[model samples]
Target: MAADKPTAEAVAEQLARLREDYQARLPAELAALTALAAGFGGAESDRARLDELHHRLHKLAGSGGTFGFTALSARTRTLEQQSKQWLAGSLDEVEAQAWQSLAAEVAALGETLNKVSPPQAPAILSARDSLTSDETVQIWLVEDDASLAEQLRRQLESFGYTVRHFMQIGDAEAAAHTQRPDMLIMDILFPQQGENATEVLALRPILRALGCPLLFMSSCDDFESRARVARLGAAGYFLKPLDVPRLVNRMTQILDQLRAPPQRVLIVDDDVALAAHYRLVLLAAGMEAEALHEPQAIIETVAAFRPELVLMDLHMPNYSGPELAGVIRQHERWASLPIVYLSAETDLDQQIEAMGRGADDFLTKPISDAQLVAAVRARVDRARQLDAQITRDSLTGLLKHASIKEALEITVTQARRHGKPVTVAMLDIDHFKSVNDTYGHAAGDVVISSVAMLLRQCLRMSDIIGRYGGEEFVAVLPECAGGDAQMLMEDIRRRFAAIAFSYSGQAFSCTLSAGLASTAQYPEFSGAELLVVADEALYAAKRGGRNQIRTASPHPLQEADRP
Candidate 1:
């Protein structure tokens, strides 16, 4: 059976249920703690029993405020601190009195638990819904020049963007009120609407209303104009005559960031209710989150989930968070995985000690849901950026050669096991060296990045793309037949030919050749072998003519029928 999709309403419902379960079990938990405290005969006697009592109080302290039992958590935190001090053999007069009062304090927990209402689950935006918007990207183009607007609109539409061209700022503003755009592309200068009326003044209200990202294009390259655009929070400012490819590249980047994959987080806390709460909060914020109660399963879970960050409790039964973090770091693969301790422990010395062990940071428990989401998001974003710098091509942000090969191997293996077809395409720019010789290396870079952007735009989200090397790329398309892949590559090739590049006031164009191999024909071939076959076919294409696709299959496969 398919699992129900995670949603804010669903998470809130689960949170309510969890709160009820926690509340039902609270009295019995307090009773058990009271009995444990009663049996305690000073810190030195029955150390195991003393430790058990401390652990129970520690859990209550950590979870109470999370479920809206703030007073209970606060009081229990004090008791837990005293118990820890006792365990350390710091039996001063104050410590002794604190230990003696444990039983009475634990008994008072039941009363405190009933006095406060649990906080309602926060309103969280569904991450999947936001990331996977069904509508095509809508762009508003406010360019008065008819030729420029038509050219720009056509270019954007070829990349699958819906471009709405308005000759005047007033028209774009009126259209914006009718239907909001995902992005706004406008000229810095406009015809005067009134005294001192500029495009900036006209756009101020619209920008504030839509809050969509803005890109400005203009003939004016002066400081004041640039400063005004910056003040309006323009994402990019392009100088005229605009390089359409560069503008498209900027738009691709903005869209890529908007549609980046959800950040994965692993929540490790022995307290089930608290863990669930954290998971729901993060899920609502559009991050992939899972809660693991068994500290023993940390390594296995970490490996399986491949979480960007680990949020763990410092104290757990049998296994501490720091200890688990150490076990995780033992594996060279996970050495740099961010581990954060989220505990109720406020002692600076203990937080420092925990961080020194293996954790990257420490987050005190009782953190609000908003703060938790913000902190986790910030850390995950930075971690992903750093990871990308290592694993992705700096020029195109596609997977590096080794990374793409690894991806291809993994995908091929999975596809073959399921008796499915996977196609690999080796793509290379035609006469790329000549481009470098005529244009500067910087222009060559722009051409390469332009192709990279087109690949991302033209291919399916499931397809894996990589920079095999300079001016060379690889695309792994799972379940795609050779014919279908050929058609797709042909479309990309045609689009690439249409894109115009300018260098030193001179305009030129370039094309690419692609070779494809499908698993249906080459079932025995490994990923590397399949890649080699595709490369041979690519060479064949280049030999035949500069711009075309050639397949490695002995007999060409027909395109699979589509609905």
Candidate 2:
């Protein structure tokens, strides 16, 4: 009979059970398989024993495959095939070595099977459920009736509306206050256990203060009730047992009406009235606009507001807009912050000077609303795309190495300034060279990839891991003390040592050693100094034992303390 199929976790548990259940049989099984593969060349009786061994492996394969122990099943199948060739007298010495290797592989695969936990199910099941596009709308639903609420929730989810449901009006209000949800849907006849409708009417003041569009749902069919709701600033009213299709269509229409292009404009003019007029024009177009009278605050304000584009007047009190553009360009952070001049001085030489000073494009003082909107949107979109590429790692889907390093350095500096602790760890795989030598380079690549995944799994999301070089990784742990760092390193060491790699019908295992250094006691030390200390401790670990962790001494080692 086939063994029952097991989940990944169950498979691991079964391996552990097997280790204990067949403890005495394991060594004998290994010995038999090894002897069968090695082939007792001159003995006829031993050849018969090999045939029996081949049958034993075949049974193991059939049972293991049914039980979801795939690695074991696969290894056994390969061994079974090789054993048949041996019985037919067609297998060579090199092929014999390959079969003998499978015994060791099965042992290692069993060890790995014993270590792994099951993979997690995805948090979200559908692409539409995940917020991938800016065009997708989010709606907040506040309803108390369980059945009706569930009906609406399912319909909205199916329609790709990111919906958040709340049972209590108070809870809904709290959420909206904190997150500023795009739209709100509330029930007017909110159930009252003991309190009267008058007390519920008091909630209208609080709701009005939210400033977002509100839609009310009720069963009341009177004109007086509809007028009252309109007074409460509700955009629309809907009846109970809602026409869900019509409601959804209306909601989509409402969102589309509200979906004006993001309006964020910077006005850099000394003339307050003219800047205010431009601000009025931009605001009328549904844009957020800021007017800056002081040319000196250009860089600071730009950094803070991140205005989509700047509109500057060429002639200013203290500095010309063209000169201010030149100053803003000098700041590396704001170098790409788009600037456009709104100058009355439209002389060809003046426009040339403005463009030369890094103004992306020039517009005369009498700029139309359409031209202004198009120019700003184009520049802002380009800037966002560039920022996304700059921050991402092309290879591993983690932060780019350079960006993470810069962030770590800033964190280290902040920790130093704030009198907090920081720890850095350097991890290296033990005897990685041997893996490449025994297996092909492709197998070596697998080992490296597996190690990278293991490191990512072991560390906290807050902790940063970067590929330091080939076969080495670095992690920066903010606010971690020396003792905590040691504990974390040990956990990583144990987890990494547990991973096994399978290739070419052979299974291999590897371990990692780490060195940790903290800047708690050594407050004056730089990030580079912390790295040096960690690297030295790593070398010490290699010298003492390959799979262990060594922490840097609090104080420098004396001459006699050196190895």
The model with the greatest TM-score is 1
lDDT of 2 by residue, 1-563 (tens): 55566676697887878756654454456544543433332223235445766798888777667655675677678768876776787333323224434433433333323222343222322232233212234577878787788777765554445678888777766654324455778776665544212245455455455556777788887887788777676778898757544465456556644543354678988889888988877755545577989877877777765676787888887898788888888888778777877766446788887788898877765767787766666666676557757875433334566776676688799778777788988888899999889997777766665555555544543477776766777888877877889997887777556554556667677788887888875677787888888888888888877899888876665213325
Please, what are the lDDT tens digits per residue for candidate 1 over residues 242-349? 988889889998988866666778999889999999998986776768899987788888876678899988888888888888899999999999998887765677
Evaluate residue 204 in candidate 1 and report its C-alpha lDDT on the 0 to 100 scale: 57
The TM-score that candidate 1 achieves is 0.68
lDDT measured at residue 436 in model 1 versus the true structure, 0 to 100: 96
Question: Residue 213's C-alpha lDDT in candidate 2?
Answer: 71
Off by over 4 Å in 2: 1-296, 303-321, 330-353, 361-394, 397-410, 431-465, 493-511, 521-524, 544-548, 555-563
lDDT of 2: 0.66
TM-score of each: 0.68, 0.40
